[model samples]
Target: MSNLAPSLTAARQLADEYPNHKVTLLLLTDFQLFDADINRVLTDIATFPGDVHAVVLGGTQVDGLMDERVQITKATYTDPPGTVARAIFASLVNHRPGARPI
Candidate 1:
């Protein structure tokens, strides 16, 4: 089963409890600022049993960290929400076992 939680702590707990299933933590926000702690969050997600995908919904910043495993697509101005949702769906569908879908 897939688990979608808001907080990282909760997500971690879920991951620990369901070590055999996939746990995805979706963060829906505009990419305005890049947080330094994002690295830690990514690290935690990587340790999960299933694939971890982050669907960022926002405009790409110039200084955003470029991770080959993380896929970052530009959300269209006309329908940003829909674009984000589609991107997340695509990520989930394309995600492979023991691999990170970026």
Candidate 2:
């Protein structure tokens, strides 16, 4: 919706923070549109030094991503949830390819 402007502005700030640095944006939101708004985020992120990964937790996606430099992943829920440690381990184990462990 029209609320995307603020999000885009925040994304720009996040992207411009470290010129030589790489960033992984994890968005834990209600849903994903895979629309122009998200495309804008991908576009801004594409200007970074290398490939950028955007993970959306607890979201629904209708379309596949089109950007080569930006990868989008969406995760949903099941069986309630787990402990923080378990979640962290799972996330690390299922971590995105082409990225190193933190």
Leading candidate by lDDT: 1
The whole-model lDDT of each prediction reads 0.53, 0.49
True-structure lDDT of candidate 1: 0.53
| TM-score to native of every candidate shown | 0.53, 0.46
Off by over 4 Å in 2: 1-4, 32-42, 45-51, 79-102
* Model 1 stretches with alpha carbons more than 4 Å out: 1-6, 32-38, 45-48, 62-66, 76-81, 91-102
The window of 10 residues in a row where model 2 has the poorest summed lDDT is 79-88
- Candidate 1, poorest ten consecutive residues by summed lDDT: 1-10
lDDT against true structure, model 2: 0.49
What's the C-alpha lDDT at position 46 in model 1?
52
